[model samples]
Target: MTIMQEITTDSDQRQPIITLQGITRSFGPVQALRGISLALKPGRALALVGESGCGKTSCARIIARMDRPSTGDLYFRGRQFTSSQSSEDEKTYRRAVQMVFQDPFAALNPVFTVAHHLARPMLLHGHAKTRSEVAARVAALLASVDLEGQSTAGKFPHELSGGQRQRVNIARALAVEPDVLVADEPTSMLDVSIRLGILELLSEIKRQRNLALLYITHDIATAAHVAEEMIVMFAGQMIEWGDTRTIIAEARHPYTRLLLSAVPDPDRPFVPGESVEFLRHAEAIRKVSRDASAAIEQIGPNHFTRSVTL
Candidate 1:
């Protein structure tokens, strides 16, 4: 089957809320993304995993309309949106797609209280027409993220812990009633202990709201926590993609295996000599996987891997 056919088949009965078809972006001579294609459906998430500079943010920016793709089309519910849209349409689109930025501290205004942060979006989006309604909605938003509506709503970004600040950011995103959520490494900056809590919150929100989520992270292991499917990108190309469990358990591509191997293994004791060998293997995989190739091979029922030009 062709790429479009595969998308259709995988989508099953549910239509994709957002679809990226053959998307590509370039800067001068450098191509940041190469013919990337994926779909995000309501109530489900697809994780974009790779090391830094693997074009993960570029894809997220395109989906969030923060940046435009140089080539290929972007669609919302089968309607092409790559071309310029009217003011009203643009406003609607922007409101539907909300982004939770990586940095909790930088995502919010230092001076604004958490209540203000959540209230502003509801007011601007017309979700709350009255001051009282805005206040109520802000309280509910804070509560959704497990924050105390009374105490937490009055605190500023600096007054909260990193995890709390991130929750506030998430609450801000939720305040808009977005159909899609692009969480770009939402927990990478937080302490390791708090990462799982944020991931769990995202999962809960996605199910409760039936929101399509695009989770971008360099840590492949965390993808399993928040996403139903996974796409492993390398050097601006999707090297492997499929069901998250299948991809994690039976990763076919060398690059995908390299990423899994990098995940800390608690059962295996660390050895001094093994570190050098691991580094050598990782370098070898990177060298080969960086080469561009268009050939795609189906490895399983839903899994696919791209060939690397030698």
Candidate 2:
């Protein structure tokens, strides 16, 4: 079965806020994405999981309109907008779809306060017309992200912790009242202890705002925390995808298993002689999983895995 067939959910009956159909991107001789298709519906998140250079960020950039697809159709609420979009329409589209970048510190300006960052978007998007309204909306936005409105508003980015800065980033994205939120490794740069809090905040915000979220991450374990549906990509192609808990419980793809097995376990100590053996095994899996002509198979009600040609 193809990925499209397996990804058919009852939620799809409701028109997706953002849809990527056969999206492919390339730069010169290098192809970053290949026949990628997915839908993002309100109040649901689809996690894109893969190692570095597997085109996860490329997919996010395409969806966020930061980069255009080399070949594909991008649809917003069932209307095709990939090829032609007027200036006003484009601006509207951008406002409706917001992005939370990976680097927390880099996303915020050191010179700006939290209130300034939030208020600017609200004023620019016409969410707030008056100075008082912008200030009130800024306070509300910070509160929505669990930041203390009074204390956080007056502080600059450098004054906050990594996790706190990420919260502000999310609040900035929400200021525009976007229907879709694309978070690219939002927790990767934070301390390990606070990652779960950030993930929980994202899940809560999704439910509260009814926002379609595309969570891009390399960590398979973390995907289960923030996403309902999961897509496992390898070499620019989706190798497996399904319900997060289901796929994690019974992963069919060799590549998926390799990723899950790689998760750190304090109980399992590393052996001195295991490094070379593990590297060889991982290399073998990569070689087979990289085959372009792999056939997809539906392995469960919502689960699908690709057959690696060996």
Candidate 3:
């Protein structure tokens, strides 16, 4: 689907809610991200697509304040707030921007009951006071995630299904009333059928709360379900980005085309080996796409590409 500008109003087009300008990251000799630019509009989801180790996770980490960008300007609500952030500022940022990690099972504490898990964030962020208020809010949080209040409150992480644990993670992220939500490979660990439920819940929460979202995943096919805009990254650099519909319909970047070609088609059953072949070739594409290039070609409205020259 296309970016719903009609639904999300830009604040006089002065700035995006979250903006990363020329982001770059390096780990010793390895370059994790390369001059990447992205934005998260309020009340809309922006999907960052790439293969494993393509820097999608690194980008998510930077946005969540878990890691600092080696070179880039991160602007929150039009103000520059990079790694130099003060302790108080960092605390506020943590409350404003929350993250939902990939492994649902590992995210929550097995020893803690659901109530304790939910209470900590609400208490830490000063969202609720008194044990009575905390208990009340925990129940509400569980309900927000579509879990039955009474039953889910006492269950531990191990007691719930993969999908249930993920829902709790989402609820915890929401407990702080954050402005930006970053989810990294959130549905990859869930059953295929259950993934859609989580995606729908996220969409519902976004609309209801008007929270800007950064949805990071390797599955390009799933981007259309949650994100209105899209960015296709190859070897840590963004090669193509624009409206989701445009990218899926008219993918220009060779890497982007390679990704879409591998997605399963509903009209016909795909041969088992086809996707495997595409995945096997992914590394070859990244090896060549990693070359830092100064040139960028605008293919269409909100569509651009940085094709590697042979």
Cα lDDT, all candidates: 0.86, 0.87, 0.82
Tens-place lDDT per residue, model 3, 111-195, is 9998888889899989999988988888988998899989999999999999999999999999889999999999999999999
Please provide TM-scores, in order, for all candidate models, with all chains considered together.
0.94, 0.93, 0.89
Cα lDDT over the full model 2: 0.87
How many clashes in each structure? 0, 0, 0
Better of 1 and 3 by lDDT: 1
Q: In candidate 3, residue 214 scores what lDDT?
A: 89
User: Candidate 1 on 155-187: residue-level lDDT in tens?
Assistant: 888999999999999999999899999999999
Task: Report the lDDT tens digits of candidate 2 across residue range 1-310.
Answer: 4455458653446668888888999989888898888889899999999999999999998888889999988998889988759989999999999999999999999999999999898888899998889889988999999989999999999999999999999999999999999999999999999999999999999999899999999999889889989999998988898888888888778788778877786464222223545545887889888887888888887888887643
Question: Considering lDDT, which of the candidate structures 2 and 3 is the better prediction for this target?
Answer: 2
Shift in Å, residue 107, candidate 2: 0.7
Ranking by lDDT: 2, 1, 3
